[model samples]
Target: MTRQRVSLRQELPLLVWLVIVWGALWQDFSPGNLLFGALIAVVVARLLYLPPVELGGRFNVLRAIPFALGFLAKVVAASFQVLFLAVVRGPRVISAVVAVPLRSRSDLLVTATGHVISLIPGSVVVEVDRSTSTLYIHGINVRDADDADKLRKEVRETEAGLIRIMGTKAELSALNQEVGA
Candidate 1:
């Protein structure tokens, strides 16, 4: 079997990110720490055989601003909602597993969406069906069909925003068709 060679350009971002992460973990930003982290990052990147993620999409930083803001807003709102349910209502809170169908076939989009949803307090991704591109999310306080539908809609809207920020034209067109349908 032949090994695929990864270019320096392709590994640069990963190397930089790893160094930053290492610095953060050690809580040290000194020149020595950074240099050591860079060495470690290079070694890890060279030794580790990981799958290559194809980020085949046009990234719009302008669109990312609103997405970031919206994600923050959702985090705050979901925190309050989860707190209210857990503290105020306690045992009466209902939970349900809801399946959210994805519009984008891109692995990056699906993985990003899952991470975003799981970050929110009231929902967590339990499973992902890559075959059908569906996410099974465990939602807190989902009392009825309306609540489930609302949760699904919120996830779809979040995905739509993500697609706007870093999705290919084909994914965008698929999103449009899904919305229109």
Candidate 2:
């Protein structure tokens, strides 16, 4: 398949993120190291024939700040919950694999939601149906139908939060409409 040529402007975010990750991995953010990382980032981006990742061309830092904080809080809470479950429930903890259908069809939104859900200690995304934008999340301590429904709600809520943070305008509008309804 012929790949559409992506402009440097369109690809800048990926290149910049790659450089930051490279610097972080090496634990060296010195100018020389960052420059080297940037050089490698550009080379990898250019050499790889991956499809372009389309961004929304906008990001809401205000929205992201709260989302990030909430995510951190969830991580902490889930970590303790997992530890408690392991100690208390031991071998009898109930777990379920639940399918969550997300509102956004964008691959980025789906992937981001999956990561957020998996980052929480008690749950991990086992599979993704990209065509349907559905996530199969395996969650520990989900003992009943109510728990499964709750998980699905949380997954969709995460996607909604992401849509608020960096989704395309149309997606944002759709989310607003859904909430409004």
lDDT of 2: 0.90
lDDT of 1 by residue, 1-181 (tens): 7879887776777888999999999999999999999999989987886766667447889999988987898889888888788799898888999999988778989999999998776789999999888999999888899999998998888789889888988887777887799
Question: Residues 91-114, candidate 2, lDDT per residue (tens digit)?
Answer: 999999998888888888888888
User: Which regions of candidate 2 fall more than 4 Å away from where they truly are?
Assistant: 22-33
> Model 1: which ten-residue window has the lowest total lDDT?
49-58
Model 2 pairs in collision: none
- Model 1 error, position 13 (Å): 2.6
TM-score of each: 0.85, 0.89
Q: How displaced is residue 81 in candidate 1, in Å?
A: 1.3
